[model samples]
Target: MKSVQVFAPATVANVVCGYDILGFAVDAPGDEVTMRLTSTPGIRISKITGDDGRLPLDPAKNTVSASVQHYLNALGQPSLGIDIELHKKMPIGSGLGSSSASTVAGLFAINTLLDNPLTTMDLVPFAMKGEELACGHGHADNVAPALLGGFVLIRSYEPLDIIKLPFPEDMCVAIVYPEVDVPTRDARQIIRSKVQLKDAVTQWGNVAGLVSGLFMKDYALIGRSMVDVLVEPARSILIPDFYQLRELALAQGGIGFGISGSGPSVFALTKDPETAKRITNTLQQHLQKIGIRSLSFVSSVNQQGPVVIG
Candidate 1:
């Protein structure tokens, strides 16, 4: 194939207690990339849509093109001729893995056009280059699930060990992206470098409980374990009415509620789609009442990470 278009699902990272460690993909709010081989010698980003001219077009600066370039360089093809068009279906910096989705889409597109030169997992490091470019840190919480789908746990970053965790098949997520800005870089800066020993112990237990709940299919355990004492306390202040939203979600039959990634976007977990929709609708209505325009989505866990669309 000379060209291929691919779609990669948006992800919810730092899933509450598992900050920088856990994440899961959602079905909607994804990004698409169209890439074609060209006679030219280097990667070129020809178009970027839905960013309102906020994203860079230069291949070296853009996450999508930079990721593709990383993949090419890794394969010993430093001068591969490729052109990419990024279609941002989701809001940038929405705490929904927007950059990761686009990066995964781009990397997948090039790999598909090259006839599957690399496995999805193999493309992760290249995708991290995009994350490093987009945000200062090369974290994998968003990119891992965006690439592998389902829930992922970063067991170790030193050796880059990623473990895909089991989740309830009927698990539904309600996402709300309020019209607020919460840059990941700024959010990260506010977090405390040192945590109290008691808080650390509690966080560890919650993370373990969450993982166990997923494996055991215990929704209640999952709900209880979704508490985050480390990062959410610092980051929640960046989002408007974060505590009120969480209370609303819980009152509306949500299994759990927490910030999606950094802030400005939050998510609630529900057992059924109806409850998920209700939560999102109610949340959006509340945000509207507060004079905050918002976007909401109800989605099951995305099992397919990336797909060739064209």
Candidate 2:
């Protein structure tokens, strides 16, 4: 194939309990990237859209292009030429894994055009370079699910261990992106370097319970275990009316509600699509009442990750 276009779904990282170890893909509000092979011997960014001119044009600086470069270098094919075009459909620094979607889309597209030179698992580390550039942390909580789809658990980081867990097919995710900018790096900085052993134990148990609940399709257990006593306590203060929103979601039949990744974008899970829509409306309307303009979507989990379009 001379060219390929891929759509990578937006992802929710942490999910209240898992932090940097878990995430899942959503259907709408993703990134689109197109890659075309060229005879010249280097990657280039020919066009970009929807980034408000804030993103870089140079291949070396852009997340999608930088990931493409890393993928090529890892395959010992840096001399090959490729042109990239990025369309950022989601807001940046909204805790929605915007950069990860773009990075995964570019890497997935290029790999497809190259006739599947790398396996899906092999793409994580290469795509992480983009995360490192964008957020200064080579974390896979966002990118892994965006690349592999469904619910992803990062079992280990030393050897890049990941597990794709089964998700309830009918469950829906409700997300509201308030018009606020909270960079992942800044949100991460507010976290303390140390935690009490008691809190650590509680967090571990909650994470374990969350995993089991997800696998067993136990919605009640999942909701109970979605508590984030560690990170949320510190980060929730950064988001306006965070606790009130969580309370509203839970009252409106949401299974659980919490900050999506870092902050400024919150998500809630519901057992069915109707409940998800109601929660979305409730959240968006509440935000509007508070004079905060927002964007909201209700979608089932996206199991297909990234797909080739053209």
Candidate 3:
């Protein structure tokens, strides 16, 4: 039997401007899952730790179980047996790629145990299957970064191609998850049915600039490009004091602040750890003042993806 432990870093999706199309990883806050191939020819999954009674363990509902099953099917190993265990170190529905981490860990474990049957590029679509089970939509932006790390720019879903940018060393990302629930499906619905032509043109132009900013390592342009003129307007209604809080974070020496993935959660990018810490305090204090409880995490930009830990 082959056993392996995997860690999939938490990812920030839809970082303000790019909804369902952009995501980046963070190192300190993440989830872990362990997998081992069994002598038998069946599949089983168990949630042993974290998420105090929040997540379902059944193979049909669990993210890890589904990804491994998909991998097995593609490799003509349907009869292959595996036992999976999930450690929900990251909270469920926290918008930190909770489900994506599960899927990535499970898929990576199986591929390694089976002697590296698939490449990371080939495994992306399979990882996306896990997201589909949760949101009824599969956007590779989050999964790709959770598995591959760094910043990802997803150009098209049909062709499934993304460019991995070289991240800056001085970058720091502080993620704030208000202890509130915003269903991914509900958040998606809140976006406008259509966008104005001017907004559409500006949105694409910003996307282009955001993509280019990373290559040039221009933090200000990166922050400026983080503007959202389409989905954010409608979605902001779902989050209490969303606009007011975002403005406060930006004003307090933070590079930028915006919605963190169809969220009640918010995040900001800073040039250094000190700025990140300052932003976290200001954002949390503002949320408390508004009667919204929140948990803040300050993490550096994850430049590397998931890797086996012996």
Each candidate structure's TM-score, on Cα atoms with residue i matched to residue i, is 0.99, 0.98, 0.96
Model 1 per-residue lDDT at 304: 82
lDDT of 1 by residue, 87-136 (tens): 99999989999999999999988898888888889988888899999999
Model 3, range 1-310, lDDT digits (tens) per residue? 7899998888888777877788999886877778888887778874458878767778878777877888888898887878888887776777788888878888888888878878876789999999999788888878999888899878789888887877678899887888888888888877777778999889888887777787889988888998999988887887778877788788877787888777777889899888888888988898899888888899998887788876
lDDT of 2 at 5: 87
Could you arrange the candidates by TM-score from highest to lowest? 1, 2, 3
lDDT of 2 by residue, 1-310 (tens): 3888899999999999898999999998799999999998899899989989999998889999888888888889987888888999998888999999999999999899989988988999988899999999999999999999989999999988999998788879999888877888899999999999999899989999999999999999999999988999988888878998999999999999999999789999999889988988998889899999898888899998999977
Off by over 4 Å in 2: none
Tell me which of candidates 2 and 3 scores higher on lDDT: 2
- The per-residue C-alpha lDDT of model 2 at residue 27 equals 92
lDDT of each: 0.93, 0.91, 0.83
Q: Which is the leading candidate under lDDT?
A: 1
* Model 3 poorest 10 in a row by lDDT: 39-48
Can you tell me which runs of candidate 1 are displaced by over 4 Å? Answer: none
